[model samples]
Target: MRSSLHVLYLSLANLLITLSITLPSPVQTAGTVLVRRSDDGMWHPERYGGGAPKVNNPPSPGPALAASTIHPIPSPTLLEATGLIPFSAPLETTHPIPSSLPVEPKEPLRTIKEPEPHESPLISADKFNKAMTAANFPVPSSEQHVAFVASTKKAKITSALEAAMYLAHLLWESHGLQEVVERACVNSACPGSYISDLDVKGKRYFGRGYIQLTWAKNYLEASKGIYEDDRLLQHPEMVSENSTVSWETAAWYWGAKVHDAAASGNFGRTTAEINGPLECRGGWSGAEAARSRFRLFTTIAPIFGAPGPFLEAGCY
Candidate 1:
């Protein structure tokens, strides 16, 4: 009976050991990743975490690893799922992209600089016509005023002093823009030398345009400078016939010869450049003409903002 009891006890112990070895391990679902023990004695992920549903589309296995060292191949989806490379955050209204970028200027830097001392805003038509009237000039039509202003701007004559001197010359020379040609030459009895130009089939280049542009050579040069051709020499009458051309020719002359002198604040120096040989000399006639030029400048200049007691009067 004792031997039989001992045999039963040994059988029970062996059965308990077999049951412990054969029964499965308890499944854990607490962590972020589902893992399993491998033959290599490493815990490897079976599936991603975050309650992701199981699918048949398991990731392909990487190259075989050695016993001790292992590096899991990071698939793009695996990296995203594992929080290694996190998903982009949701866009917010708090921060927005800019609509426009800074742009560089197309013009040269020098061209955009502030106006110089000699520069000023152009005078208005009302002011110009009023100044003309004040200087005993005819109240020029609006069209005439526009033509003159355009011409002056084209020549870059923007200063009040220069415009004052220029208009004075015009007033004296053209008699307030009333006469286009020299009155002395009106009857074709202009001095013989004035008629000596053989060009233009007997068309004389005697004192035409607002400044009374004289000489065939002057007509030719003005034509080249203004029209880029011989139009003025070919047809000198165009200067008188076309009002715009008349004003432009005078502006061209002022810009080329008289601008610097007028800018110097010397009225006599300006007259010397225009008709120095005749008008700048101190004869009775010259003095009278100088006085007239001075008087006209004084009258019209103040209207254009030129301060007076202007002392610069005579060329001599």
Candidate 2:
């Protein structure tokens, strides 16, 4: 009985050992454990604190260890069943968008042309006619004198007309028609002169051109300074026929220098004295003609767009 009891006790002990070896190891769901292989090729628990839990069956031959083992989680997608990430974040796109049509560049702006310098502003013809009539010009009842002057002296009728028109404009701007006529008659050898002895023979020393530019020195200087032609002094009649030359001489004579001098109270007498006896003989007495001529100048200055005071003071 003792022998039989000993055999049964040994069998019971062996059975307990076999059960412990065959049963699955207790695995904590929240913790991890590591198992190492023994010489017999069976896995046995080696680390229990913080290693991967032992698999129920020996892991099947997994893919060979990757050359680069570190990997980031894949982007979330509905197709990946094992993936547990939530809503997809916006993708950081880097690809450029393809365009189907080409864009045209804007055209450059065009520049506008400026108006011509010599062109006159729009003014009423009635105003011009009234002004001319007021100045006693009467708009040439016939073109006879204009034609004669043009033919006899090779002068231009158009030039004379332009000069006359320019003068009429001045007269309208300055004093009345009578004042203009009286002023123009000063020292003038025309049909009307305050003194008969001052009148010369056959249109000699007549107020020839616009501004009645007279005196040899004045002619020479004006021709040279304005027209840049020294020979213009010889053909004094050309001043009436040539609008270009006439206007230039007019500008120089009636412009800033004489204007400034007159404004300063000299009245252009001091400068006239420089021309010798023939130019300034009677002194203040002779100045009457000059003063009269200057009055006409003042009257006509407005036509050329000069101010009244400027004309009065000879300020060009």
Candidate 3:
């Protein structure tokens, strides 16, 4: 019985070995093997079947190809129009950026305000008259003397008064008392008629106004920064009508070297005393007129805080 059992076991083992050699293994069913085509267009399995899908015929290739390579095709026009192109790439450009271009920051809006107007410096007639009265001279009875004095040789009344007033103020500021100038005016020998003409040789010379700014050379020089013409010196009355011109001329005369001697001291005492001389020529009498004219300045000085001759005499 043991012998028969051994022979049966040997037969069973041989049958198992034959089945293993004929049928595919379990590993073959788990994976696939690739099949490649030959140049002749025939396909043959390169590896044993491992439960993979079957391919019937080899695919035809027109050109030689590299292993593991791919070729991309252009997108269809219809697909591009519909914005459905697959794997579309963006284009690259090479434009340069401008260096001066400013990047403005956005700001919220706001409101703004406007500016105001300006005013002038002219004084009123009442204030001027009052100022003159305060200086201590009797006001002229009529514009007559002022007018005659101004019109003496084509001199404008307004211009004469303005010049007279300007000189009076300057003199008053330079001198503490207006009486000194008044005394010079009443006593001086300078001709009144000649004082009206503005021409150098026309007779009227250095009539009214400060320093008796006489002579064509002196007038011309004084007028340099003051008036357009030195002829105004020939007719000193123009200084009154034209305030700007009058002030400029006054400043120049008072500050000049030629008049330095007479203009010395706070009251311009030297000039007043000189004008007081009776033997003087030309507008020497006008110096006395200037003294009278100074009365107006004396009256006005307090109101304007103008310095007396003493205070105004020193160089600034």
Candidate 4:
């Protein structure tokens, strides 16, 4: 025990001597220490710190170690997410080898997709309807309005202008006629003009279809020419129920020969031609029904680019 104490004191004194060596004037830190170091201020293989591999001067060739004396280098891949490489001691290998092959970079994560929306309404189905409504247009029937829209493309009528004019008159004939009579012809009663003349063979025929297919003779003649069936003379209400037949009858009256009075866009004159005998009998200004027809034409004409009424009458 006394000899072992003397040996421990010699070892401690040798450690103190090794630690007293200072860095040389040329020594500076690069990534790892590049300068050769010695213990006890003398040249020898005992480096103070775990020394770096030599740069300008390689380390001396070492003797092959016995297999049992070797240790595996710590793998860089063993690092935890804390970014620490756990090594209980200095990293060393049986032979100098590359530190864990250059760490491979990772790819980024994928994101979810979303739906896209449309930008403009120029190609929408209700584009025309919305525009006309914004302009405060009084569209008649949806069916008739569609006809007007279609006319802008292919023009089943002469033009959209003609379709507008045609639809305006039809609108008045079917929906606005009563209002016209109530507003102005209250005293004269335009529909009652043919009072006794309205019935034939016990089936009282009032104004029934577009433009009011009034009078039994008119119904019989229209049904024969337009439907090729005279049955409407006895059942005139069928005219109101069958829109196609009613409109066909009106078209027939419009295109049948020529009423010079309806020539061109003489709107007031057209009113006179269509129902003058009943409503315009008192003269233009007094003809409320004629004036109402003109009112509708004025509102609808511009939408279809129809020229304004070239000839003005007091009724318009």
| The best candidate in terms of TM-score | 1
Write model 3 residue lDDT over 122-176, tens digit each, in one string.
3333444555456554543334233323322222112222333343544453242
**Which tens-of-lDDT digit does each residue in 107-192 have in candidate 2?**
88878888678643222244344445545555532232232233312212123223333343234322332221224544443454
Name the candidate, 1 or 2, with the larger TM-score value. 1
C-alpha local distance difference test of each model: 0.69, 0.40, 0.40, 0.50
What does candidate 4's lDDT look like per residue over 1-316, in tens digits?
9999987887676556446545433221112222323433333222212323332332223222221212233345533333443223242323444433455677867776766775432112353344345334543455744443433233124544454445456667766322212223334435444445435544555666556666677878877876687888768667666665566666655555213444455666666656767666866554777776666666656655556554446233
Best candidate per lDDT, number?
1
TM-score of each predicted structure versus truth:
0.59, 0.33, 0.30, 0.45
Q: Lowest lDDT 10-mer window, candidate 3?
A: 88-97
lDDT of 1 at 240: 92
Q: Which of the two candidates, 3 or 4, achieves a greater TM-score against the reference?
A: 4
lDDT of 1: 0.69
The regions of model 2 sitting more than 4 angstroms off are 1-99, 109-130, 139-207, 261-316
Clashing pairs in 2: 169-303, 170-299, 170-300, 170-303, 171-299, 171-300, 183-292, 259-314, 259-315
> Alpha-carbon error at 99 in model 4, in Å?
70
Give the worst 10-residue stretch by lDDT in candidate 1: 22-31
lDDT of 3 at 313: 31
Clashes of each: 0, 9, 27, 0
Selected candidate, larger lDDT, 1 vs 3: 1
Indicate the TM-score of model 2: 0.33
State the lDDT at 115 in candidate 1. 62
